[model samples]
Target chain A: MILSEREEEWMTAYQNGDEDALERIYTLLKQPIYSFIFRCTRDEQLSIDIVQDTFVKLQRYKHHYNPKHGKLKSYLFQTAYRLMITKLNRRKKWRSLLPFLAPLQQSEELPHSDRMTIREAVARLPDIQRAVVLLFYYHDMPQEEIAQILGIPIGTVKSRLHAAIKKLKKELEGGYNESGSL
Target chain B: MSQDPFKQDRHLRTKLDEYHVDVPDFPMKPSRWIRFINLLASPAKDPLDPLISTPSGLILLKIAPIIGTAVVTLIQILMFL
Candidate 1:
């Protein structure tokens, strides 16, 4: 996750109070961070919020960023992932306390989503496993970098990816498509 | 569809590709800007907010008028003396 030269320059410029450099970094990093978060959370608003917070955090902690520490994009992904997990955890706690909110939360689903689609199957994965799958298959991230982002050991990341893939294989055995039934 | 793990991975990725997510562009300043505006648009604080905003402060506020009247009457009695 070492920074490329261009990212290093951006970080240096950002640390020098260059607002436009921060914007440039955001322009480069936003899509990847947003994609990872949206695919992980499956909530557009939540993803946007996390992406926005990630940039804000980057700006707030600009002085702490060193190219020697990691890649800029990985740092962004880690921030978004942690923010998402925290918010989602808080939400689950609230939902448990107020079960009436379950219906409201479920209202995000489509009305016609009866048959299990591939996306649904992925969504049904546990949060930990879903993160692994999305990071690996969707984002094409390697195990070591994912380990860095998830703050887990490389072995743990592999096991999670294996567990996720096994669960996905089981859920998607029937070859579900976006159109519902094959 | 395929028994090979690599092929299965590829197949899974392709299936996931079907779940297209489009990330929209948003300006960086709007969040901070909205927050500043919200702060500005919030209700004005009472001049005595510091005096009455807490329990002790509220008690002090409630007793101030009686204390002022007592002090004024005491000053009048002293003037008579």
Candidate 2:
């Protein structure tokens, strides 16, 4: 079941020590939270670890959450983003030596031909544009919400979205006639 | 011999949107009491933690003011005596 508005309320209550609310919110948003983290990290073990740690951090510092700031999901995403940055930094040393952290055709499921091409095209964009694309299309976020999440201007979101779409179209279409399916 | 690249591809967007993969979960099952005890026993490593250091450093931080007050009070009492 989708996370209901009541469930979001209950999550805050759970953070405030309502035990029953804890179980309810866990069942409600756990999968989506896991999926979001997984997409961010692109590592299953790390994503699960981060999700668990995010909830732990949430519970441990419930007082730090300012209701005036935004919705519970927004707070959660911000927290996860911070944690993901930390994880990436920590993994940097190891990643440099390995040089294989990002590889072609490495997505968990061997993506179909079209999907693989799209992921490759996405991987080529600059980091900010890549993040904008992921947050916009992957998360199904609105332009204003994407701005809030990325701390970029709404105009920037529009421009990046436009540029990204154009770039992706160029790359994808370059492969279209070759694939003989489009 | 070429398609209009500026023409937006709604199908591509929809296909990308539908891209879903099974992500494995790394679930943590630490009990609350154990987690709490671990929290209390281990010095917090978070940058914001007040006691993010050796026990002596934390003790020195917490009791320094009280110790200063006590020492001054003791000196005053001794002088009066």
Measured by lDDT, the strongest candidate is: 1
Q: Write the per-residue lDDT of candidate 1 for residues A1-182, one digit (tens) a residue.
A: 33446877887888988878887888887887888887777766667778888877887788887778877777778888999989888767866775444223332453344455677787788888888778777676778788899999988887787788888767776655533553
Q: Candidate 1 — which residues are off by over 4 angstroms? A: A1-4, A98-103, A106-115, A176-182, B1-9, B30-81
Ten residues in a row with the worst lDDT in model 2 chain B? B39-48
The DockQ scores of all candidates, in the order shown, are 0.10, 0.06
- Pairs that collide in candidate 2 are none
How many residue pairs in model 2 have overlapping backbones? Answer: 0
lDDT of 1 by residue, B1-81 (tens): 113243546666666677777879776543766645643553332457687779999999999999999999999999999
Docking tier of model 2: it is incorrect
How does each model score on TM-score?
Answer: 0.69, 0.63
Tens digits of per-residue lDDT, candidate 2, A9-72, equal: 7866876789877666555556766776665555655566667777888778877876566666
